[model samples]
Target: MRLAIYEIREGDEPHRLAHRLLGDFRRWTELVELNRLDPPYIANDPAPYRARGLRVLGPGDRLLYPYAGAVEPVGEEDAEAETYGRDLLLQRGELALMGGTVAMVRGLENLRGALERRLRTRLGELPAHPDTYGHLLHQYVGRAGGEAELRYILLEAERVIRQDPRVAGVRLEGELLDGEHVRVLAYVEPIPPGSPFPVEVVL
Candidate 1:
């Protein structure tokens, strides 16, 4: 397989990118191996590898991939039947791999991913629209706060989630995972076209 350059996009994930450009998400290993990336979140080892933390590839990041193929074809059911939205499937910051390829999600799950990501981002983190792109929940992290602060976090999370046109309504709840972390559960009611769903985001 010949090598090709893949300029990562905002939503690009290794497995998903592999599937889109290499005909199989499983080929993400080829990306790591070719790029000589060390202990990416997908590494299968113990201790030190786990301690190194995940490598986040943002927009403009370039990766070398082999077998640059056309984007994977949509499944017959999805193409001929309902047009469920398509997106990369991720779990705990890593791509969910199947048979060496990345897994894919559709429809409501796509919305869930969007909600999770929005809540995890800190307000003003995006340079293009520094004033409007992220959430304030990150500010409360690793600091002392009481009921009022928690309530504010919830409100902020709800506001951020509702920004997605897909979300019709949202109910938020939170728990102190520990002194340094918080987990927010958002039960989102999608627009009339889809069913309601819950998304968990830890910060």
Candidate 2:
């Protein structure tokens, strides 16, 4: 890993530093984690800094850049932002699949089955909790009753994921596969506060 130094300039926030040093602000999360720096970002746009605390790189602050060939990590803020964007895209694209362009591709029988397989794998891997009376065990998961049991065991997981402000809504369901395995589906959406039809006047 090569080490380099960058002098913080006026209003040079961590994300900005990532863009300047790594050519992509999205890697800011990595940068801050690497240097153990606090993020100094505030935003009206659901900033990435929420996941990490960082301070803006004001003038006179020397920041460290660590790198391995062809890999540039963000300054520890952009990843959180990108993660939100990505989560939104995943949810939007997934929901749109019920009807939309992506549906055609996602419609393939093999692909749908593939999604089922992947979902099962992901949920099955959640670490078990000792206090849960041996709950969330990877081995016992993906079985017949496991789906219902998981809803309770993973209630906190659901709550935490739903905590994302952008996450407008979420629905969970499970299906018995081949009379054996259980495939779970989580549908998420965002519904802005409003009435379908409203009238407003302005001067």
Candidate 3:
């Protein structure tokens, strides 16, 4: 597929770009894939979004628009649709948190990182100035209140985690330390062939 550069405009979103460029809103995933967006958060005003470790093809940024018919449409059974990778998260080597050496990650190691990533990022934290989602654990972390209060907070977190397409299950474990801080332990099952076993993460 031959590719062309499409400059992002204010208030622009991937679905809009895909429809205008190819007449198929479902092809929004294609635009994101070709662009290799890290954290894959699209936005207009990207400053706050970027601060949350999200990737946005913001205003004035140029992205790839393959010639019509270059990218094949997605199918339900397609692994790309079923899992994160090309559809959700960047390939292991494409983006790194620390620095170099992440390019060679394999199997569950990659999935572990991916799960942790979604947890660390806040929802609205990664979008345009007018964010409606993304409030991470750190934002809510504080002195644990009554048992009912803690349960409610964790339930809210579980609800958010369930929203991620790749996450099939979420189990949270936490303990109040000295009544001042809560240590959150998160366990997640990412869409597989990364791993069928649950992965653990401390947030």
**Per-residue lDDT over 92-194 for candidate 1, one digit per residue giving the tens place of the 0 to 100 score:** 7689998899998776667678678778777666675454445777667667776666777787777677545345578889887777787889888865346
**In model 1, which regions exceed 4 Å deviation?**
1-84, 124-131
Superposition TM-score, candidate 2 onto the true structure:
0.26
Off by over 4 Å in 3: 1-107, 127-133, 136-140, 194-203
lDDT of 2 by residue, 1-203 (tens): 44444645555666777887888999888667554444343222212332232232334334556534555675433432322222112342253344444332211222223223233333324343111111122433444565565554244223323322223355655444543344445554422221122111110
lDDT score, candidate 3: 0.55
Sorting all predicted structures by lDDT, with the top scorer first, yields 1, 3, 2
Q: Show the lowest summed lDDT stretch of 10 residues, model 2.
A: 194-203
Q: For candidate 3, report its TM-score.
A: 0.44
lDDT of each: 0.62, 0.39, 0.55
- Rank the candidate models, highest TM-score first: 1, 3, 2
Candidate 2: regions farther than 4 A off: 41-57, 67-203
TM-score each candidate.
Answer: 0.53, 0.26, 0.44
**lDDT, candidate 3, 94-201, per-residue tens:** 554345443334344544555555555666555542243344556455644656545655664565455443455778766555454555566776544334444443
Q: Which ten residues in a row are the worst by lDDT in model 3?
A: 80-89
